[model samples]
Target: MRADHPLRAIRQLANESLAALQADFSALYSGMGRPLIPPERLLRAMLLQAFYSIRSERQLMERLDFDLLFRWFVGLGVDDPVWDHSTFSKNRDRLIEGDEAARFLSALLPQPRVKRLLSSEHFSVDGTLIEAWASMKSFKPEDGTGPGDPPTPGGRNADADFRSEKRSNETHASTTDPDARLYRKGPGMEAKLAFLSHALMENHSALLIDACGTRVSGHAERVAALAMIEAHADRSRSITLGADRGYDAADFVNERRSMNVRPHIAHNLTRAKGRSAIDGRTTRHAGYAASQRIRKRIEESFGWIKTVAGLERPMVRGVDHVGWGFTFAATAYNLVRLPKLMARVT
Candidate 1:
């Protein structure tokens, strides 16, 4: 009974990973009184909760209050009442919106010279539509009370005298989830007011270094991948980037070339599949073609976010909030991932 406990093991892992991140580099929310909960524990719990898809701060708070392992992961004792869930939704933006996770993901996955056996640095970049939590339902064609106001005499029908009408992104400014826009990237008519999330993780380490939340289509995937490159701020010839067909655009290739990094991007050969051949970009050059082979690794990053960070869709409304949310999830991902990576190196 006197020996080290299960919770102790979990706490050690959580704190180690947290220590890898830099929450202080942020210049956003300063002088916000004394911190009530330890930043590391609070951040880790958010990561765990997001990964499990558990919604609401109250739910997270309840779990932490009850789960001994979770308490330990955050370094709270069995008797400690973890901070309430609202703390996450409230304070998280300040910590995550900027350099928090990237600072840590970067520190944990720095490139090593003569470390020829590692595969984590070989990254694949891809992006997906994180369906917005808001609704086009708010985009009514007729006037109505702004959220909680009340029905104006009669906006019940289109024929009625109305001050406003439900307008799609094709028109009027939205009073709800205004930052979201209708986006359809799927094969069919399906679309969403989506925010895009992109990640760059070490293939072997599974440690994510850079991530971005954006709404611009056509180029969003490549833009995010480029952001990762820029964040690393590396122009060294040793780094090679991977990405799917979405990034097969000429600009991406030129951009990578300008940076002195190799682009192993897949060829967008959808039109020539049966008409032409199986391989596209990878077939063009020995290195380009070979580089494209590993772009699939980036998909694993998003998989971890939705699977482990509870962010298949954001809980918040605006693009800014969704961006913040993705950052939190990314930070959470690192918190969970760092421990396992350390275990390997140790």
Candidate 2:
């Protein structure tokens, strides 16, 4: 509450972000349970812990009990009781993914009289690897033991074809985690089993319209990119899909075009030259080049999700739970973005 205190800024940011989420979530979450804790307060506290790297549920609880701003964000007045961290983790499971976060984001899409930062038409697409909650060590593949068996103990590094070896973290490994898999940009390298998170960002305002995380591909960048076409399909039927070199595959390009979407994916020099190229004839599209240039900025949104927002590794096991965590993180990120989005508005 002290104006001079450093945490005041944190509290204000946390409060505003939570307030936005509260409005979107209130009606839908009503029957999920009594507002066990004010969703805004609890969510803001979670965001603070993540952004500040507080780490672990216990640490978040301790801070809430002692820190004033945290207390305020979690809706605890001086005399009110603070909810336990477990209460949060418990109710959080009820939060939805796939559609829930998207719906909340849709609600906050725009305010009256506010012009959008990025025009719906001027958007870019990209994806990033989110290391799962499992470790390569614990994920050793099962030796042909069964159809969906775990990797054998010592054989964790067996296949150069698997994506687990390259993407798994060696520097700061997690103890409670056993499901993490390694992944890399290239194939035949199983570094970490990862979730591919694709995001579609409106360039000028950097608002994210859609995001989908998957566990199947090492190349989620291209996979989640189908989103651009799907979302834009009903709007105009014909749209430009911009992306990086990873999306320079024949099938991916063909797939986008078939949907009536123009593929503005960057040309991969290595593949663009030889006999492997998409025929020099078909490679000539100006819009494609322009789209490639703007694709880098798209990475910003995902960067914020992984680093600034602390979603690099999922919070829970199974793709579904991890997906749930990402939805909340994305919702939180948009809340942080709302002020910037509305800043220039009259």
Candidate 3:
């Protein structure tokens, strides 16, 4: 690969970040077991999956076997044998179980080189639904009893008629992934089993400062936003939080104010009988308009995550697994954008 190729920057960033996380990786594995795939290589492979939109571990391994660029990026020699896809997956689950994904993301921004690009006092938060791997057909009643029989019985793809039969998260659950909840993005949108993924982006550089995935709920967006903001907020110095109208709630605004964070949420004139929680006092500021404008850039991160990173419909099942993928994707998004940002800074 050329010196100016994007992966060169990404690989440098990954190397620096992984070097800082060596101890954590060591702690995750036992010294006695037959040597497993190095956690660093596994993480590099995961990053490649996000970078190239490789859909599955099997396909990823196939590329790693023959693609010299991938081999170089992953620190594998040309003649080294690739691990079986199943073995790669099993080791990946171990990393997820050890919370290495979140740790890796946390290790990135604190680097002196990257820290300068962050905005300490201005940020944006948003959430999108991550469709669960489970199918709606698996959403059966919790009681184990449902409408008589499938249209095509004794087969895995049997048709289920949900017409006129009331179904809800309260009385039903997905057998495939019990943690998933049925959710609709809008009034007329089709509902699907999904988890809500939230990202907190610093306005100055439009880099994701924090991210998480949570069970879908009516208030999950606001709740997750508050949690992430609290984690990053400085109580002595007030910060500004930009969000869409979905975050315009009285309680959420009050909570932000209590934390010395200004809620620069867009006015939801249609909500609460046209009474927006955000009043003229908050919107009158010049900074509020600026935040509103900068906040949209966060969508670029989300677009890359879903479309480029191939997480629009996550392959993972449970909330923990989904959260791992979401956070790792955030890190990958940062890596992809950082090269240009650093070049411009230099």
Q: Estimate each model's TM-score.
A: 0.75, 0.73, 0.97
Model 2 weakest lDDT span, ten residues long: 140-149
Q: Rate the local accuracy (lDDT) of all candidates.
A: 0.61, 0.61, 0.91
Please report the candidate that would top TM-score against the real structure. 3
Candidate 3 accuracy as TM-score: 0.97
Model 3 scores what on Cα lDDT? 0.91
Superposed Cα deviation of residue 269, candidate 2 (Å): 3.4
Superposed model 1: Cα runs more than 4 Å off: 1-14, 20-35, 97-99, 110-121, 140-173, 232-238, 270-290, 334-346
lDDT string, candidate 2, 258-284, tens digits: 777666666677753443324454458
Give the number of colliding residue pairs in candidate 3. 0
lDDT of 3 by residue, 1-346 (tens): 7878999989988999999999998898878867799999999999999999999999999999999999999999999999999999999999999888778888999988899998899999999889999989889899987875546656658766788678899999999999999998999999899999999999999999788999999999998998899987788988999999999999999999999999999998886579989988799999999999999998898889999898899888899999889999999999999999988889
